[model samples]
Target: MKKFTITRILMLLGLFLISSGIHSTNKESIFDNIFTVMERTSSAGNLPGIIDNAGANRGAGFNGRYVFVASRQSGDYVYYWDVTNPDAPVQELNISGIGGGTFTLADLTAIGNHVFASNMVMPGIFKIYHWNGIGAQPSVLIEYDSGTARLGDAFTVMGDPDDFAMIIVSQHGGKSFYVWAMENGELNFDEPLVVTIDDLPANANFSRVTLPDGEDEFPVVSGPAGVFVLGEDEDIILTIEQSFFPGWPMYVNIFAYEGGRYFAFMHVKDNPAANVMYVLDITEGEDVLEALQILKNGTFAAKVLHSHDMGSIANGNASVSMDVVIDSFGNLWLMGFAAGNGFVVQRIGDAGPDGLLLPFMETFDGEGEDTPDTWLPEGWISFTLDDDGEEFNWYWSPGPSANPNGQMRSQSAYQDDGTWYVLNPDNWLVTPQIYMSEISGDEIIELSFKIGTGAQTPGFK
Candidate 1:
């Protein structure tokens, strides 16, 4: 036997391997043949550049080049990081001394050069600080002591970066939502604009909304609806109510206001009746409908979309709404959970089957299913190669190493030479859209028996 090491053998075979490559190296770009690994430097496992401590990081927002971190109410420090080199992040500053009393921390958001911190304790004031993007610490610009309405839990900074607006949902024992405008180094109003159901555009569609079982006495009116403003004009709102009605044990209502009309985009009445309100009067029919209702503007009726569950996983039960984000293009991104899959994200724009979406462009966290495939977290298909309308072997999979039995993968996958393979992209799993039939008044909408897409509703559900 000849004396040879593994290194020598690999070096000698390199030429032969290149000669018989899978794709032609002559035509392919360098990027096509290269793979890059992202090395993360974090104070915690999930959040890079954040300190791993006992207190949870409540709120985080970006202002130009800095990433600010706001700790929970118990935490005494608020920090920022310089992410000029994302691969290796550097802690820039840590700020404490917030809240008028002890044990009261802050939640933060930034608009241009201003960082706004809201604390519910004492002064019950929202503080705005000057962030010049040149220094590590922020200077207190102004503080608005809005009576006793504590801008506590949830808030979002919206509109253009230079002249932005904030929607702060306060929970000072009673819930309230407020919109505050900001520009240059000041606030445009003495107080934030309060959002109310009365402010919603009056339309005929409100009469058509129905709750779970049938019993309805106008569900509980909670304060401060989850609110988000799109651009300078459109405002979106989500509200949830606790109900005793079997048909709608809980109701999630999504409303949007644009061009003088408030459209009810979705009303997901959770039919988890037996789980919450046990009533013997509802013995005639099914227990859970858990359906999604979608509506279009100027339309009088809403369509009850399909019903499906991601089931329970190790992490617990998941819903059609897990998380939501808006892209720079202004399209909404919906994230839902799956039992076997970690998270599934989808974009919502132009209505699929329901004529509800105004051509917009549109993921997940859910529990596992009753009979989840292979106990694997990742499944589904990803497109690889595309040549105009036609494609070749577009399905991308982790192969035998990551998914030996091809768990949670598509039914279109097949076995080849003892290894599971994904040869077809036609049957790739995508979020289901509402499609209407051409039959005029007899409108038939096709819903998914398994996979589906709906609102990543603003509610905490």
Candidate 2:
């Protein structure tokens, strides 16, 4: 009787362990094919020629080549940088003579060669300063003095400035927002269209008001409670609960890349370590509503494509601005700036589902022993979580003493003249996206691979 009882307990324990392992794997696999990774390419703070005003950096804007950063003080200046080589950004221009009356320059947004900055000169008196391009003299595009509404806490511009553009600005600490239209380089300063949202948290200052180009009908706003999509009737069409966010949502934007549409936002909290920037793939839906609906239903864990730890770089009000730019080489990049944290540039990888045909195989047949160390087969990715810069990644290796054809290989560490040098290999090699749509309900799939190591000591996992 005792032996039988012990055996039963052991069996139950084994089953529980197996169940836990399966659950963990399933949770991880859900994000495997849906999200991309935000690899930080460059970041710098307090560089020469750039203002180093901590906690005063209010906003940033990108016009293809240049990234403009503005300080939120009466006499502070707006600086621009040329990040052609993200690794080494060069400060190009700085404009002064901004800010007056009650508030200084609060935020900025750029489209094409045109840049716009906002300032609330006095109570209910808001002015938008326009620049044709960097180094161009600023002109007052629109000045409205009405009610007790406050503008310029956060704003965004949609459409092409060369053709037609619409500027959306939020009333600070209020539920109402204002919009203006510009066509053929002419501004219509006529009475602005004011839309008021219902159930907006009291004293909730909008951190961002984004209207994706050509999607003016559905505008998105980020505030204290969460991020919301406002419909034509000023109703909250969709809501991304604040609980889903890592911190208070401060900035949000949408962009398209590699035939995929993505939504990204930066959040902040009292603990700077809690701050993070997240990106999600919205390409599964045909339209904005459909994409957002999928995201709302899928929950945060399932839809998040990427997350970058902001660390202690941002805190306090944590006013941040982000913009997406496509380089001349057609690579997509996300540029971000926080008042006290400076700026960061990350290259957006193509991690969306490719829906490639089934039975995919990568034999690494074309690789030779002499292949360049940095070469990687198309669609394959290699990266390391550590910033130590010892990126000794997996490379093509001609098999030893067996098959002549090459195979992918990685070395844990190396010994030089009796001295053991630890590489501390914390790396990942990801395969290309594969289609899994054929797997139906209750279907089982298998992934098989051959892995071996030349060393006697254990390394590969």
Candidate 3:
């Protein structure tokens, strides 16, 4: 056509690209949108402390602006962070000496102001701590010493508004549940409220707990690798165990209470060879019934592969083992450990039935980055979004660029004055945008992209 310089044509195309990207400009403000998470943690330096290798810890919320985290670096101690500010989480206090002689690294639980933590050891020591609203350090609330008793590994603590909180030990030398009571962090009950396979709806094949040689007992007392509590209801307890039992089978069991009968999903382990995970459901009563056959699911449980095998990856290493939390809007956000994998924030609650995922509140790596690299390894990271209750659509950069699909849409996402907010698009009728609201609000801000859409699509698949 007419004589147009390359620069002029490129400018026109750029403007058109920007214009086409703008769908609409209409806007609306809908408040009362809140999200919930289960567990979250990060390396040292995320919080304020002279302690090197101190990581960010997260769990269910408590009080006003504090969170219960499974502290990583410091003997897996539990610490409270003031998240009222959301971004700059400052350490309010710390709890230590929960039983193990060495560094305690495991899960933690909290109800109201009270907290609990555990580590791997025979007759392991389960420690408790309490935060009293006012300025008080989290002191040792209680310590449940497993002593020489075959202790459960990877233990988790859960409590209700009532008096007792159940400590679900994945490997209690047998199929059993330890129930403990807390009178402001003090263990009120003496022994665990033992729920085993023998007397319930079924019988647990604890043969793995005993060695084949017969000389030594293969006590099911290996530590619970992980734990999850489905609300405060006495309905069901989701426990994940990592033990040498049954040939070191990593298990995921769901002990559900229905009517008066207890149904269980027993003995799940990840197969290294096939890169797959096998899960089974069992029931308790006169005999331990294997309800479901071995169901094979994705083998992403192993962080080594999940973080490395896929292009877009998620790392839920909150030290709590895949802590999946369903939010108020029914979005499931998992907070645990995310190392070199930046795709975690992108997926958020993408696993639910309706293409929705839980919203991530915060993520960080202690000690600022040494280099300004756009990756997960070098820096501390965290994110919070205004989810409109819609299954957020994943958007890539420029055109067809590869980026992890996140939970929400954006109208404007500029970094100004350090505050991130969504703004109405330039021309779209209902356009939305996000930008930094306050520069000093969130400590670590990360933005990344991937290549594809839908769960079946392949970018991080």
Candidate 4:
């Protein structure tokens, strides 16, 4: 009496795939709502919801039941959503006064009852707000300012007391704001603990990132707090890619208390050459953290899994500066803000060297997870040269297409920030970097791809 349709069955199968932690990875339609979750994996059925705010979405935080978002609107406000039923989330509150006194949120993060947000003003001020949970009125609990800190970023809530947060001052051309921690709900007129990098007693501006073996050397003196210094000589290591590399991602874990010790993960961010994960052991107590010791067996932080394109503008993004959360079930979820870096969830195996990831290929074990091949490997990149030979720079759009469907299909970079990198109408739209990697014994190789001008316009290459 009933006919089962293949399309219907596939839709159900797609949803099931998400529950298994492997969602869609389509980047054809920007802001088209391909995902209902943070991972934004593509799906024909799973459409995402968008909240309208001019400019860019700075930061977002999830406290189990509510999704607090900070997209600088006309005023300083933090939007909270009732995600009790994620299927139909409703904006329950628009708590303004985030960065009170004409300042707006530059970034935000939250856990349990506390939500933290900061502004990019000269003094570098951050405010914390607390709520009684579902459908409750939120109020400013505490506000702090570091007069010397600038480019305040990665405002993550350290769950030790569930009340404090660590702010990374990403100031450039400066010695950089070091490791600042705040806990009490009040401010002290005296200076807070500012970790000064330029003045380290060792006069050590740089060090080998991976212990005892790594060779790549990057500037460590200036920029953001990617490296968590442990001992006197910067000997033992736990750090993300330093901020000197513009747009390079830096993800650090909230200090976790495990086996009578505090630990967090850092990113060396190398593959095929060095270990990507660096496990850290912070000293006990929040106020005083000694030099961390690298745990050779701590493999949880080294699992390298790739997500779909972050869709950042200008292809300026090499890393997705994600926020790390290691769940109780031994699952690690790296969450991204609404801006760039889509969320990626991975189940880490034993605590040593790349741990027990489900290896899809033999060549990539204890190294990193293998990325699945895509139809268009070398994605689009936008390029333009003026008559005088000058190149066009980066420009963000409201949406690459008609509306903000959140897709960046044809740009050289996987940019879905709504900004189209426009070149001279007849110049060029270069593709991503591509080079031959191998020659088989037969010395015969074939390349295949699909391309269309989408127009019959002359000189449209």
Candidate 5:
């Protein structure tokens, strides 16, 4: 017999036992449902006349009931709109005379009542302008001359303006980025910490960085190569490959809704049909690194909950700003800029209910007739790293006579036209999200499954 190996998975069962502790209520994740609430094209003429300039609108910021957009041309101005009614955003304020000179404005970020904007006055000099309110005059908060480094491609600020905050900025053509800290609402302009990321691509323009809410350790960076999740020590922990994006990832943001967290990004170049935005649920892992690893390597596309295409928008230089409002209910909103196109707004709906209930089971017996041989179980995802695309790593199989029900098996070896080939598969089988919140304190959770290998032979290793 030609020796080979076949790994079989019989069934997966989750058994739950009742505990005496009280069952706490859980809020649903907002990323589960997403819908576009409003989108304004540049041709709509609803924005200021300066917005019509090519590659003008760049960065976006959200503070209270107002949304701020920065334009780079005509006159370096920041425009504010009253989005109390998101559908009808009334243009309100036009901030001009920033830096007291004509410079190219790049990006804008806001936290609470404070808004900050960046401008690259020249190849080696940049300034970060700050404003306390809509009526306040902007001032140069941090001015730096890097000699030869192109500064202020994109940046973000996190935390409260009246309290502590941190700002992250990217060098347009350099291998490193810069960070500054705020102590008691004052920026530390003496010296900014410079971090050089290894393996960062050369000449990668339009780089953007963002730190997750309440997370001061990990900062997610996006560039032409891909999206990298940096550890507290500035080491690259996880990377979402560029192949997963429709174009170069221009912006990335992490937001928390209810008790769950999500990752969102937009491409620098828009697809022919529209500019796309992707969101992945990263709530399972204990921390951001583990959650991203699970989403990138393990669960794969199973956790990608949303991908919205804003129609025919030209994202000259894309940017995304997220905010939440709570009145009688919680509302999560995303404000984005489509360079040549106008502003786009989207809302993520509540996740309705939590994930699957306890005592769940999957037998892999429901193979559809359309693909009887390679059918996958519902809610189960399978992916392979093989570039050939000719073979699947896992498939449905009819078991032996003694166990004829069905089985999920991996492809280890096969023969084609009398030529025997040994297969090495890099693949993953990911289960759907399971809600474990019901388990009370000190309660033990158990995972059990049966696995066996078919075709045992001495020659097979």
Candidate 6:
């Protein structure tokens, strides 16, 4: 047997320690081989209109499925797509109601075999669908009667619809906070549960549901531009710490349901121009519940010279904007304009808020700006797979800049399958390229990407 010197053994141990840290990041790498591409395949076919916020219902245990707002040309209704098989997903249902008037609604959620959706328009409405579980056809149930004032624009349905305390959050005039619930499919309109706040409107630029309250709690908050949930059933209520303050932040809020009390987190920042994210803690007066935070990255569109504008459009429409998406793993993925430079993804770890972290991430130019050169970026990102903790597979989405030939390469330590793949789209397409690989476990790892500018392409290879 070959022996190692003392120095060599120490080096091996050092490397082992570093690898251990990487393993600690994830117990089992969820992304083994499943890939999601963000192509501009909007079923609605319309760019998202100006709205504070919208999202699919989480109550419907349909995690890992694509549920987003969609509209039809024939009539106004929200559409749901069974995107589990993303490569060839099929529309499962067309949700509509009386008169079939078009609605600007959020996506649907699944509860057992039932799905729920909401329309935040005035006189907001909610639609329920029952799935037999055998087929994709979703049977429409009678709309839940939300006894809210006819001053709706930005609202959301909280809690499971099948439950007795199915609630709806209604904001009228950006000041009034109304909570309504349906019992036996009938709405109790006369008993208007109002949340009183000092000075603010009925609606603001942003809102969200953090918790679903119990039978007695009716807590809520409204402010110039912040909100948070107070409590839920026996869950802790979040109290506003005097130390926690919002200094002219754009839009931030928290919502929760606890012990008949609806907690709202509202950060009142005095400076209108100051933009920052504030963190809040939820507790039951004494016992700390959980750590929650609201980050606001508002954008201000600026007018550039006609020549510069044209150049920007020609060079891939670089206006410098940012957006955030919370992934299945509860990771907040932030992308877009970076300072006076390009763009990057801001990664946040599962730790307390005080120790905020920021890395150089990445920087790119107009590398994969156009078709034929828009699938992968050069030295942009690399992916790998872990099988039984023994061998790993690695691959990189190829870019024209890295390999002008526009190709991708993949390799595995255990398998010798020399296969390289490429998928391309023409024009200013804005869909992420997805890739999948199989490991020892039954689960497959997936990678979803939106590559922008650099010496590489902009999609998956």
Candidates sorted by lDDT, descending order? Answer: 2, 5, 4, 1, 3, 6
Comparing 5 and 6 by lDDT, which wins?
5
TM-scores of all predicted structures: 0.36, 0.61, 0.37, 0.43, 0.62, 0.36
Candidate 4, residue 305: Cα displacement in angstroms equals: 4.0
Better of 1 and 6 by lDDT: 1
lDDT by residue for model 6 (104-208), tens? 343233333344444444444444343434244445443544444432233334333444333434354443444555444344443445543333323432333
Clashes of 5: 0
- Sorted by TM-score (best first), the order is 5, 2, 4, 3, 6, 1
Which consecutive 10 residues in model 4 have the weakest lDDT in total?
A: 359-368
Candidate 3 lDDT by residue in tens digits, 1-461: 54332123223433112111112111111011222222132222132342223233322223322454454544444545543234544453444234453335444444455454454455556554445542455555445676654443344444332444444554434554444444434556566554343322222221112110111111122122322222112222332233322222322322221111111112222332111112222221222111111111212132111111111122222222222233344332322222221111111222432443322232222122231222221112222232342322322112223235433222233344855543322211111233334557558644432322221222121
Q: Highest TM-score, which number?
A: 5
lDDT of each: 0.32, 0.58, 0.31, 0.35, 0.57, 0.31
Q: Model 5: per-residue lDDT, tens digit, 236-296?
A: 7778787766676656776666667677776556455345556667776666666677777
Give me the overall lDDT of model 6. Answer: 0.31
Candidate 2 local lDDT, 1-461, one digit each (tens): 32222113223333112111111123223334432222221132233334344456667787756677766544556667655434344543345445463656767777778888887543666878888877687777877884776677677776666666667777776777677778777785566777666666544465566754334456677866787887655667788777776677767786555556668787677643444667777766656676788877776767677766544554565567778776555556676665555565565333333423222222222123333333334444333223443333343232232222333343233444754443433323335435555568898654443222332222222
Candidate 1, poorest ten consecutive residues by summed lDDT: 273-282
**Model 5 clashing residue pairs (backbone):** none
Error of 6 at 390 (Å): 40
Clash number for candidate 4: 22
Question: How displaced is residue 348 in candidate 4, in Å?
Answer: 8.9
